[model samples]
Target: MSGDEKGPVLQFATFQSSVDEGFWHGLSSLKLNKLKTDETPISIMGFYTPCSNPHVSSHLTLLAESLPTEPSDGLPTATTHGNRNKCSVPGTLYNTNTLEGYQSLDKKGLLQAEGKKIWEDIRSGKAEEDSSVLLRFLVVSFADLKKFHFYYSIAFPAVVLDPPATLVDLRPASEWFTLEEAESVSACCNEWRMSSLTADVPFFLVCISSNSNATIRPLKDFKACQHEDQKILFAFYDPYHGPNNPGWPLRNYLAFISARWNINKVQFLCYRENRGFADLGLSLVGEALIQPSQAWQDEEHVPKVIGWELNKERKVSRRVDLSTSMDPTRMVVSAA
Candidate 1:
């Protein structure tokens, strides 16, 4: 439609996280056997897919398979190769020993710390090398083994744009592209998604020629498109299907674009899908205008972060009670 029709300031749909019971079981195994009393951040993974249903939103999910098969005690940890059904995003877990430790954690400071890593990657060109760096997240938890209750909080740290980005134009991909352009873009996107090498990659560039030919390239090849006369669209596998809003990943993606490319205006695609293939009806394409600030030039200063999964309008931590289902003694008694 139009920028005015969608709203001026761009709003993003936040991720709703879901944890499988097996995830807690795996954590318990690691804590008791391999990582006793260790407070160091452990590498983890989270999975999500493009929103396929109009009424439902996709979740950032944690399963037992998300954790490493072995501890990295001087040995390399083996990571899972995610498939199209669930693309893996890297994350970290900070398992505190006590409730006091978890409660005393500097939430704001932690978020900024993680956010700074992302900002550094953007400026250092590491995010371009491996675009998955933009989706990194952190989790702080107190796994009460005795009570089988886990108190935790998750943050998908996003670098704040001081002036915030303005939407110049926003609408469905079907409306934004002509018939030939849509077909070419969809074919290119399908090829990107089906490849084992690029299927898990979340960010990429789509170059469209005046003749409506489209090609998908890795984020690392962004520079290659500099001299091309084609229209370049920054695309990501959007996990949200909101009619007007993009997903959480766009926040850092914008920061990366503004910092790395110094491009104030951007064309982007929220590449959503239906049944594992590209769906132009559910996807969105838009142009955003951002202000590249002087603060970004300073290496030491990191922008403010704004991602904290909320609960009932409060930025409070959450607790999950798994005693009934996970406690062996309780389970045995219930069976009797």
Candidate 2:
């Protein structure tokens, strides 16, 4: 297909900052360690698309079917408390697709057959035979947009999926003050840090309704939904904010990363709204503004990191110097 018919292409830029000078010193000290380990830094890439149309279900199904299957080794072994075996039970196959009339009948039959196969595997003990199952698959789902609400819960022997332990309602605040919000969000993030330090398992938190009008504190203050080592952070926001509120969601997100986490980079995938300009204005703003520019080739490129020097008191009080460096991409957000 030609470039025009290839579908929407989104771009992203990620920034990294260190609050503790020791962190930077330690990183520089580790330069030789990295070379010895031969571990190359890596970045993540994702695609975002509108989830409201008829094609959403088909897209989700296609992605799920294409995912790599788990190996035959026994599931990850766990000795933790609270009947850990409960998590070992394979998840139920759910049908999140909304269909009408005759379409519903045909789809339902196909889904039932798929579900049956998965259920049989679980019952026969064929699914739980892998030791690294838990860490093998990622669950990709759109928790907000109505167009694509399907969930792809991978079946792995080593990985165990945990439900949300805490719910944070951000609707109470009327507005957010950048720095102040950061502090509050930092407190919430402490919870995740503590969990990560204690339990060796991963966790996750899903923001139910993030929008411009919705009160969002800094990311540091919000508690971490999962452990620090997990590979994913699924964030959702209502796409109603205009250019003036462009930085709100991102700022709060940075706060989350600031508390006990070093964000090396970020990547974003955006799904353009299919509706005409009248429905959702065609302006380039917020997450939509990250598209590749003509000046920079159409292919996505990594962002440059601008460094700075800190004050004697260890505070970011003044800019001492600036330098540019290339690093692996960190976070990836798909916008649709």
TM-scores of all models?
A: 0.94, 0.19
- After TM-score superposition, the amount by which residue 259's alpha carbon in candidate 2 deviates from its true location, in angstroms, is 31
Deviation from native of the Cα of residue 261 in model 2, angstroms: 28
Best by lDDT: 1
Clashes of each: 0, 36
Q: Of the candidates shown, which would achieve the greatest TM-score relative to the real structure?
A: 1
TM-score of 2: 0.19
For model 1, the stretches where C-alpha displacement exceeds 4 angstroms are: 1-7, 71-79, 313-315
* Candidate 2 deviant stretches above 4 angstroms: 1-8, 11-73, 79-177, 196-203, 206-336
Overlapping backbone residue pairs in candidate 1 total 0
